[model samples]
Target chain A: MNITTKLNIVPFVSVDSMMKLVLAIGIEQFLTELARYVEEDFLRWESFDKTARVASHSTEGVIELMPASDGKMYGFKYVNGHPKNMLEGLQTVTAFGVLAEVDSGYPVLLTEMTILTALRTAVTSALAAKYLAPKNARTMAIIGNGAQSEFQALAFKALLGIDRLRLYDIDSTASHKCAANLANMGFDITICASGQEAVEGAEIITTVTADKKYATILTDNMVGSGIHINAVGGDCPGKVELHRDILLRSDIFVEYPPQTRIEGEIQQLADDHPVTELWQVMAGKASGRKNSKQITLFDSVGFATEDFSALRYVYDQLPRTGFYEELDLLADPDEPRDLFGMLLRAKQAAS
Target chain B: MNITTKLNIVPFVSVDSMMKLVLAIGIEQFLTELARYVEEDFLRWESFDKTARVASHSTEGVIELMPASDGKMYGFKYVNGHPKNMLEGLQTVTAFGVLAEVDSGYPVLLTEMTILTALRTAVTSALAAKYLAPKNARTMAIIGNGAQSEFQALAFKALLGIDRLRLYDIDSTASHKCAANLANMGFDITICASGQEAVEGAEIITTVTADKKYATILTDNMVGSGIHINAVGGDCPGKVELHRDILLRSDIFVEYPPQTRIEGEIQQLADDHPVTELWQVMAGKASGRKNSKQITLFDSVGFATEDFSALRYVYDQLPRTGFYEELDLLADPDEPRDLFGMLLRAKQAAS
Candidate 1:
């Protein structure tokens, strides 16, 4: 088969390919570039067609499809969150995405997004910290030391110059694994025994617990003023991390309010609670951190625009990296209307 | 690589495989089996979670995602319709879909749906006609002789024992092609120059024109009492095939009312228009065709449950036919929480 005969093939980046690409570009640089893409998309937020994710809740977990388009390109991610998947030796969250040309509606790229989701989620948090965190803040606390903890630590180090991490988990083995992963990465890491000890003397805090309910991981007395909290885990209707009193004391910034109010930590608050849109802060229309003593909260539920940016970034890197395989995902007959003829021809070709 | 090492891989069925499967099963038998699946799901329609398709419209065309879940399995299709695409030698519509386990939230099958969409749409039409069309309906007229003409003709032949087809299209070449495709398929076929001539003596009339506007393909004067009309072409907001007077005179049956009222031929009717739900008719809770004098119209805009049934049928045939390839679309590590470690290990393995 000639290469030109397969123009309908879509480029697919598998997990191995994504890992090789990330390692080839250097993980720190990958996070930095991904953060730049997220920031750039947030800067032009109004140009996107945004909608809240369409979710299907089941007894086990939830499966969601997040779709967004910028009129030129279209992208969507299929993701599932099953907290009990870890017991079955599966990742709690796994994802895959497609990017297509809006004009032709033909897919250009399909890639594994389980790894990319972790990278983008961390980069988005770090980018928010750049605008919302206090000036000269370096020490950060991560409450859940699971699959996302190491990425968050690395992204903050790359984007916000945070070199110290205070980590805690219900399972100490997880904290040990995270600490060992970041051992030689030039961070002063301390493995704490409890969540309260992890936030001690920390300037920024990120809570990414794995439970799927409205269980409070942090009380109002634990969160102090002048600290920026990146609430990463409480991102569903009944799932939240911080206490309502803590949210009342802080100014919250979110990706899209319509979506955030449903899936972010602010779901616990009243419907009309005033929260600043993160794009407004990025566009300089709204203040991020009002003062040095102001308690700031980055309610970090993931958004579609961020995935669109990540997909766009991966598509841009495809030419340079060549780390993709083309899959025959579309049917393009010589004469488009004679699809039956194409099928009949296939039978003849096989014979 | 070992076989078990790729356990996380998904089975992908391309267009060629789908065609080979259909041919191997015999086209008529395939349609019969697919119709059985559609009818079975309709019998238990209340068990499925349904939502209206998420559509993104551009100046040229529209792309949509149709998703549905039956508590145990979930499926969605990504489809695009561009009316202007045919001018550039491209398909007016192309589609692909995924089926996943709701418990595990892992995709099991990914298949090209362009050809499958045509087959399933025809099967769905034939299934609806089973309940809605008049008894002993044999001779039928097809208004549009484009891509969907042959399938609709064959499905009716296999399901309803229709032996005669009168086909008409503005483009005579399309009608000739449709006639050519069904030459030896055991049908008494006639090529008509106009829609009025096509429906002259037919008991059932199927209007499936390709125009994306509200140009009336069938006038009120052309339709007679007791004739069952399968309105297939006018499926979007601004697209309709039958005249408003024809719809008002006909007792309409729809797949899903909330969806059909927005995209089906009934979009021209009032929001409070009384229409019978097709599933209720299949479940024997509602009447289909009351009397021979009553004109019955099946406003077939298509629905997610039909796609879900088609995908389920394809999945059941995968193991028997062995017509699929494995795609490593998921990221599964040895230790689920140590995804970063998986990346690190890949670097060492590559070296």
Candidate 2:
């Protein structure tokens, strides 16, 4: 039977709605589901033609386009990261994507990514932690508790079997919000006074601060052996979070090397610094965490492939649930040559 | 006083409706008006930061993202060209675009461009022809007779005093359709059997064939002196309509050499091939045709600036006329951190 009676116009989940969608689905279930999809796409990674995103930076922020095609279909995301936007009542990260048929380049999906990005980021963190974090992990220290922190908390709880969260933010309200959301999720909470205090005994530490600076969110002394660091915030060049010494302690993993080298925390290291491609690890061509005591770092800057997978999943599943509206977005010419004719008729109809 | 009370959403003119909009505006009037906007934007050329569009090519077609910024605002056009799509009852060309604030990357306008592409292509052709075609030009040869043919005829009438159209198409029905559309616009028409026969006494020759190959629609021997050729269809690499011999005798003009080299008809020529940029001629920094005897060719591939100008104009004009439906395509969050809260409220309201 057909899943839905109506063709779902592109489901536009606003940033606000996305937060609810995650909550309604429960963080654990969402993370588990999203991870399954990301893993499925990563195994066949060679099928994709990947490129570094094209970015146009302004004095305030940067807008970028990340496009990739897996021979049969093409997908791209237009995203912007403006940390100061929160003061203007706007989310720091807002995005949208288009998935088109590679044969004809017809746009088959369009979606609001402000909320999805949060979900995808959290899901990605959980996915990496599953492979890199110590087994039977139960506690996660969330530093820089801003927009993406709650999702990270939920994702870890769902995927890594984490039962406790230690939250710390420069702004206490951010920490309060994250802890409040995790209250009923079976994750025990600790409101830490500092990033160091939060990471003291956590098995996995997730840093998602929004400040566009070279912030050392976690230093070398803050961590003990066997902790996995999911570094999510430092994506653009000159924007980083982890200390140089912390990265040297762990075996570094990256999504796209050329890009991660420029935008991830690895940007601080030498060009010839040793790093392993995450896809290799996912495909078993490379190892994930060698041993429980081996310090591991997943320098996640977010890749176009993850967005492609997210867009694909959203287009496939969300429509069946009736959370979308059809848009008369693409022009359909009844008689292609009579384009001028249709405009005249619309003018007549309006007049 | 609000001049328009119809809607708040920007009017999305579909390819079909865009045709009707063009028809109502009168192709000649529309083309003439479009030329003014294009000419004005070209004069302030340095005010725009130009980059060649990013493209993904497959065996069947190609998809491209063309972006540009002018200090205050940013714009991008997502377009595709698939010659075989017509066989599937889909138009060979389909497009859409977004206009956003440079500071925040907030999209202010999103529109259907399949129809607007036709209008802009025609407008660009007429603008180039105005500067390079013979003063007494009246009759024109339209060698392709597809979706773009009527727009070409109208733009020529609007910008230059050319009211006579000599058309030809490999498909006779395409020529019939173009002639029928222009019949009401008061143009004297000739539906020729072949490209050679159509060029006789035609002062302006526009070749817009859709084959993605280097097939010579117009050979060197057939094109005579004092004829201005507006080559609109050869827009990607490995596609050409004119023989190399024609380039030897004609003074070629292009828009944005970096892009023209890749997507325009100039792809067949050597890297250092001499072709003057059209913007230079518009700004009077370079000369146009030397005399009526000179053969001029404008290898027109669609550019980002024209889409930017057209989007700006449409966005501004829609408010005055009131024919648009606003889409909640962008997310505007209140209390940015409580994105989850927004979803909670939306789901509650829906329940």
lDDT of each: 0.90, 0.80
- The sequence of per-residue lDDT tens digits that candidate 2 reaches over residues B172-290 is 99999888767667789989998999999898899999999888999888999899999998999998899988887899999899999987778888999999989899989988888
- What DockQ would you assign to candidate 1? 0.73
User: Compared with the real two-chain complex, what DockQ does model 2 have?
Assistant: 0.51
Task: Name the fnat for model 1.
Answer: 0.67
CA deviation > 4 Å runs, candidate 1: A1-7, B1-7
Clashes of 1: 0
Error of 2 at B204 (Å): 1.1
Which lDDT tens digits does candidate 1 get at residues A257-302?
A: 9999999999988989999999999999999997888999999999
DockQ category of candidate 1 = medium
Candidate achieving the largest TM-score: 1
**CA lDDT, candidate 2, residue B313:** 64
